[model samples]
Target: MNRPQDHLAEQDNVRRVDDVTSALEGLVTVLGQEEDLSVVLRRACLQAVQAVPDADLASITLVRDGGHYTATSTGDAANRIDQAQYDAGQGPCLEAARTGTVQRVEVSEVARRWPEFTAAAGAAAVVSYLSAPLFIDTEYQGSLNLYGAGGDGFGALDAALLELYTTAAEAALRGARRYVSARETVGRLRTALTSRAVIDQAKGMLMAMHRVSADQAFDLLVKRSQEQNVKLREVAEWFVADVLNA
Candidate 1:
C-alpha cells in the first residue's frame, strides 16, 4: 500500500545509502592521490571529522616498537587530547591499540576512567570520545580516535561507519608503506650502482697511471681505505676527485 510517510522513509534510506557511497568514494580518491603517508593520514582525519556524525575532531595514533604517537589530527583540540593521553600513558586510544577493541567514552565517565585526558579534553570542549583499533596485521597496529562536543554524539551507526573508515584507511596505509619501502630499495640500488661505476673509473685511472693490473689497482684502493679507516667507496671517490683536480 502506498503511503506518504512510507515513501518519505524509503527516500531517506536511499539518501543515507547514497551518502555512505559518496563518502567511501571520496576516501578512496584521497588514498589514491596522496603518496606521503603523513599527508594521507591527515586527510583521512579531516574526512573523518567531516563524515562522522557528531564528530568535532579526529586523530590517528600509530604504535611502533612499544611506543605510540599521534600521527595526525584534525586540529589542536584533537592533538591536545592525544598528547595528554600520551603523556599520561593511559586513555581510550591506548586502550584500543593495546586490546584491539573499540572504546566509546561517555562524558560523565570520562573523568572517572581517564582523569588527565578528561581534564584536557574537557577544557578543549570535547565531551565524548570513540576509539577504534586499526589493525592491518599483527605487526602493525594503531587506533583512530574521534572527539565530539555532544555527550551522546556517537551512536551504533556512527561506530559502524568509523569501523568502515578504519578498514579502508588501514588498506591505504599498508599500500603507502609498501610503496615507501620499494622506493627506498630502488634508491639504495641506484646509489650502489653509481658508487660501483665511480670505483671502476678510479681503478681504470690507476691502471693507466701506474701501469698496474685491475687486481693491483683494486688492492691499492683497499689498502688506502684500510689505512685511512674509510670506506672503499670513499677512497675511490677521493682518487677520482684527485684525478679531476689534477
Candidate 2:
C-alpha cells in the first residue's frame, strides 16, 4: 500500500510536469509569433523564472563573436548578478556557456569556486545559482541562469527540470533563427530581381535610342555610374526615369 506522503509527492511531481509543459508550449507560441530574437529571449527569461520553483531571478548570457553579455534578465538584481560574473571573467554562467554543460552551485560552494562572483552575488542576497547551456545554431552560444535567494538552494530535481526546459528552448531558438535568416535571404533576392529588371529596361531603352548593341548600351550605363560615383543600379534607374519622362 502507498503511504500518504508518497501520494502527495506523486501529486507534486505531476503538477510540476504540467507546469513545465505549459511553459514550453508558451515559449513555442511566442517564438512563432515574434521574429525578433531579443523579444523571444526576454520572454524566455520570464517563463524560466516562473517555471523553476527555486529561481528568484533569471537571466540569459549570450556569447557572440568573442564577447559575452547578458541578453535579457527578469530584473535589476539578475542583471547585477550576471554583470558580476562578466566582470569577474569566471562564474557558473560563463562556465556553462563555455563547456556546454550545467552548473548548479550552492552559496557555500560559490565562495570557493568563484570568489569574485561570490562577493557581488552575496551583496544581493543571492545564495544559489543554476546555469544551463543554450546553443542556437552556430551564431549564438549562451546559458540560461537562475539565481535563488533561499538558503536551501536548488535540488537535483530542480536542475533536471531546468535542463529539460533549456533543451526545448534551444530548439525553438534554432527555428526562429532559421526563419529570420530565410526571410532576409528572400528580401535580398527580391531586391536584386527588382534592380535587374530596372537595369534591363534601361539597357533596352539605350539600345533603341542610340542604335547601339546590348553590350554597348550596358557600357554606357557603367560609364555614367563610374562618372557620377553612383551605383550601377542607380544609374540605370535614373536613365530609365529620364527616358520615360522624355
Candidate 3:
C-alpha cells in the first residue's frame, strides 16, 4: 500500500545508513591492524581531513603532563602549523581540549583571542581553523582539531561531516588503548617467566650449597623470601650476588 516515490525515499535512507555502517566497519578493520599509536592517529587525522572540505589539514594530539597536549599526527601543512598551537597552548586545539567546544576563527580573529598561539601559528602561514574534541567516553569530550589557511575553513555542512570522522577517531583511540594493554600484558608475562627462571636457578644453587633435595632447596628459598619480606626475584638476585662475592 505504498507509492513508488515513497518506496524510493525509504530505499535512499537505507542506503545512507548502509554506507555509514560500511565506512565505520572499514575503519575498525583498518585500525585494528595498526600496532602503533602513531599509525592509528595518522589514519584518524587523514580521515577527518577527507570528511570536511576547507580543512586544509587535520591533527590529533595526545594528552600529556602540564595540562598540555602534543601533536601526535598531522595531515598536512596547516596541521604542521597547528603543532605550534599545542607547543604554545593557546589556540583552537587547546581551547577544544580544555572546554570541549568546537572553535572556528580566522587568523586575524584568533590573533585577538589567542595572541601566542596565533602568533606562532601565523608564522607558518595558517589563517583559519575549526576544531572538535576527542572523547573516549563519547560524553566527556576531548579534542580532534582541524586547520586551514583560507577563509573557507569550515561551514555548517562541514560540522555533520566532521562528526562522522570524530566518531571514527574515537573508536580508533579505543583500539589503540587495547593494543597498548595487550603489549603490556605480554611484557609482564615475559618478565614473570624470567623471574621464575632466575628463582629456579637460585634454588639449584641452594641445593648445591646446603646439600639438600630440590624440593627442600625450594622450600628453603621460599622460607627465606618470606622471612626477609623480599620479593622472590629479589631474593634470587641476592643469592646470586652473594655466591659470586664468595
Instruction: Give the candidate order by descending TM-score.
Output: 2, 1, 3
TM-score of every candidate relative to the true structure: 0.83, 0.97, 0.67
Per residue, candidate 3 scores C-alpha lDDT tens digits across 1-246 of: 999999997896565445545556555676768777666666666656655656776777556545544444454565556567766767887777778767776777887898887667656656677877777653224577777757655665456556666776686677677778799999999999989988888988988889999899888888989999998798998898899899
Task: Provide the overall lDDT of each model, using Cα atoms, as 2-decimal numbers.
Answer: 0.81, 0.90, 0.70
Query: Looking at candidate 2, what is the lDDT of residue 205?
Result: 94
In candidate 1, which residue pairs clash? none
Best of the two (1, 3) by TM-score: 1
Model 2, 1-246: lDDT tens digits are 999999999998887777778889999999878999999999998899767878999999999888889999999988998898888888999999999999999877988988987776557788889999989877778899999988589988789889999999988989999999999999999999999999999999999999999999999999999999999999999988988898
Per-residue lDDT, model 1, residue 46, is: 76
Candidate 1 is scored at a TM of: 0.83
lDDT of 1: 0.81
- TM-score, candidate 2, is 0.97
Candidate 1: regions farther than 4 A off: 1-20, 119-124, 136-140, 226-230, 241-246
Over 1-246, each residue of candidate 1 has an lDDT whose tens digit, in order, gives 889999997886566545656666776787777777778777777777655757888999888888888888887778888888888788889989889888887777777988876665556677778899987555567899998887566776677777777777688778877887799999999999999999999999999999999999999999999999999999999999999998
